[model samples]
Target: MKRIMRALRRCLAVTAVLAAAFSLPATDAFASPTAPASPTPVVGGKRAAQGEFPFMVRLSMGCGGALYTQQIVLTAAHCVDGSGANTSITATGGVVDLQSSSAIKVKSTKVLQAPGYNGKGKDWALIKLAKPINQPTLKIATTTAYNSGTFTIAGWGATREGGGQQRYLNKATVPFVNDADCKKAYGDDLVPGDEICAGYLDQGGVDTCQGDSGGPMFRMDDAGAWIQVGIVSWGNGCAEPGYPGVYSEVSTFAAAIAQAASNL
Candidate 1:
């Protein structure tokens, strides 16, 4: 789950430039794809059981995503280049282990990135698959109410800061950080309305890392249904104290996502 995407490095370069322009810390890194390396589980996370996350899919770019529809995947805009046809991208699902024979792989026909994404907020995007994968779809949260409490995050990304990506999916639980505290940690880099923050705060032993970008931060709703409230975006480092993981707040773009999905 490292830098598997062909354009991942280019996207990261753009991100670095944007961060510099805003005078943000160069230490801030996207929870995104990186150079290929050995595999490691998620930091402070447990290996996921098969079928535990049926909606989760591993993008060819080494990013993670959830099936938003039968043929549409909701991922981070940074995970893709832009809106256009791209048959080279693949979506692998139905198994926690990427190499499992039970896994299903589908090719993406196109990607629709969020308008005006400058490598910061507005990190969400959609990837349309060539065919529908018979699996459960993840429901995105449309209200900020679902943004609170302890949410679950899972991916094949590195288990430790600067560690390698994993072949088996892993997961962890992180508490939501209020906007005020999150803002203090990241300053102007933390987009209040456009993004959300979650982690252990002072502890920071649990969080997302590189290759986990575009993955879902979710929790069970009142009706016992999984609702995604955040999309992994960026952070200073994996599970670093005072630097909680930042994500694209789903509620802020819920309507646009639905509209985009319709057009896809």
Candidate 2:
């Protein structure tokens, strides 16, 4: 009985460590051996139903994205930095469950990483689909609406830290943290203009974890339409107190996003 108890304790310890390192892709560029993990989807959230978030997309490269237009997808820059015309990237949408057959898959024709994206802020990318999808696209947040409020984030990332990717989409609501408080949390790691912070300071057990990178952090507009305010970028650990998840601030680069989308 003593040996069995010891084995159980070790398993619990491993689970805790895995939960702490929550980034989705687990790449060297975004995470170091000493740095807290970054990326992925909701931790402590409920599963989403089909068509709940119509714009949510699952990337073949282990990230989440949002459909900006019929032919364009907005995702994290790190997910497409080295990917080009030859890369076989696919974006699956229109389904909540990854295993469902109702998904709409589109191949990428080109990938455009934001200018000067190097695993830091401005961690956004635009993927041009080979064919346009017929679903509705999410509107970008152009004002300071994202500066403060309760935001909803969704993705197909791991349900827990250090776990395998989830088959069903998960959704969570988190409060936005001010830049001042966020700065205190991330210190020199925080990018003010390029990133927005969202999560609970009290460690309320609500946050995006691994496999959710590049997913949408959004809120409803005054008209009740969904507007994307941020893109899942990085964080210290999943749902850790004082360390809210950082996202690419959509308002900061709305013009750039428009230009890139228009050109394509």
Question: What are the models' TM-scores?
Answer: 0.85, 0.83
lDDT tens readout by residue for model 2, 1-264? 332221121111233433443333444212232432333336778768778898899887678899999889998876665545734788889888665678788899998899887656787889999998788899998877656789999987765555556667879899989899999977767789898999999755778876788899999898999999999877765777877888889999999999989986
Look at candidate 2 and give me any clashing residue pairs.
Answer: 23-38, 24-211, 40-209, 40-210, 40-211, 40-212, 40-213, 41-209, 41-212
lDDT of 1 at 90: 84
Candidate 2 regions off by >4 Å? 1-41
Candidate 1 Cα misplacement greater than 4 A, ranges: 1-40
Cα lDDT computed for each candidate against the true fold: 0.80, 0.76
Writing each residue's lDDT as its tens digit, candidate 1 over 56-136 gives 998877688999997999999988888988897889998886766898999999899999987667889999999998999
Candidate with the greatest lDDT versus the true structure: 1
